[model samples]
Target: MAAIQWTDVAQRLKWEATPEGYDRIRTVWLKHCDTELRQDMEGLLSTLTDDCVYTVLRTTATGATRQRWDGQEGARAFYTALFQAFPDQNWQPEAVVMGPQGVFSAVVLNARQVAPWAGIAPTGQTVSIRMFVYFIWAPDKGKFGGEVVYIAPIAE
Candidate 1:
């Protein structure tokens, strides 16, 4: 395979530049993001580094906002629980934009309520939710350490 350029990806994403030896950072970041957003939970779990940290900030039903996953194992457990909790949920990334620092240029996420999301029975609503995620990628760690919520909205 061709050599990867972490600097190029970082600049393109408008993050920050790192010294050498971290050139593979961007590869790790994208791979992880793609795996999760593509709903390949199994694929994502395998890519997680032992010391990796990932946080997901989201607004759940019952009008409660929560942040889950403090680290690699936390993330894995979160996804696992989520899948089991919402047994029939299907979350799809309708669109994505490359932003500075491994963030997105534009992020429009659409999720369908295939099963019970919260206390609410499956409305079969097929609701479309749009949100933006700002990413912070560290090359030394070879991971997207933190991702903040750039934007999200309450139900209309």
Candidate 2:
């Protein structure tokens, strides 16, 4: 697969932040993931601001794909589809950092393809992929203002 065009994405998002801010936000992010794993939508939604934006960017040698969610409802729909696609989905954070632009997290997603995903039929095969997630903090709201996820398949 071709290398991910991270520079391009960064340009569009203008990612940056402070270390202290990143550390604090990382804690909230972990809680958010935990809530998601527990399938507690209300708790997960509590971690984000009302106007939060969630974006997913998937790129490969063939092409690139992008999806965006606008607010609480959008986030609900996004997570709903995700759980439907991988009912037993597990997210593991490999690394996390806060830069001047945003909080960046490297996570591994492990699950079985028991349901169709991105239009592909279920294979019942276990799959693992690495995702880079960037989050913008909302100090006033004490939650995240936005999140951008970059997903790529793990090399065999």
Candidate 3:
């Protein structure tokens, strides 16, 4: 899989945000996404608060799996594992809603299964998974405090 085409995603995405919050989250989230695609760990961490929490929910045929990482250290560990598993991770967001509290996005996350992921064995095939992700925004701090991703893999 290739890196995300930010221009393409931006052109097609439908977005909305409160008058007061739009500018804040739009910049933060876009930078976060950009750094993520570049696989820049430090840049990625810069976009998040020091006390940030990251959570993932992967739904498979059998059941759903949940994982959570708290604080900067945990975030670093999570990203390290993620980059190792899927270096070319990408996402195409269809819609986004932002408010004073947080931002929610509906998107398709694409990545190659180069290693075991969410308990599934490696297939070395690109997979497009529908995901609803929520990003907690700390307006005062001007950074993301947390992120929650709910991934629903396509049924085979």
TM-score of each: 0.56, 0.78, 0.80
What is candidate 1's CA lDDT for residue 105? 35
Runs in model 1 deviating more than 4 A are: 1-26, 58-64, 81-100, 115-122, 154-156
Q: For residues 46-70, could you state the per-residue lDDT of candidate 2 as single tens digits?
A: 8888888888888888888877888
Give the alpha carbon lDDT tens digit for every residue of 1-156 in model 1: 011257745455554455442345556656766776666786776555455444444555446544545666776776665454444444455555443345453455344455542233455555554556555554445556554553355467
* Root-mean-square deviation (CA) per prediction: 8.0, 5.1, 9.0
- Candidate models: Cα lDDT each: 0.52, 0.76, 0.77
Write one digit per residue (lDDT tens) for candidate 3, span 1-156: 012257734642533456656787788888988888899899999988888888888877688888888888878988888787777888788898876656789988688968775556777898777888888776658898878888776665
RMSD of 2: 5.1
Misplaced by over 4 Å in model 2 are 1-24, 99-102, 118-121
Model with the higher lDDT, candidate 1 or 3: 3
Of candidate 1, the 10-residue stretch with the lowest lDDT total is 97-106
- When sorted by lDDT, best at the front, the candidate numbers are 3, 2, 1
Q: Assess the local accuracy of residue 93 in candidate 1 as a C-alpha lDDT between 0 and 100.
A: 57
Rate residue 76 of model 1 by lDDT.
73
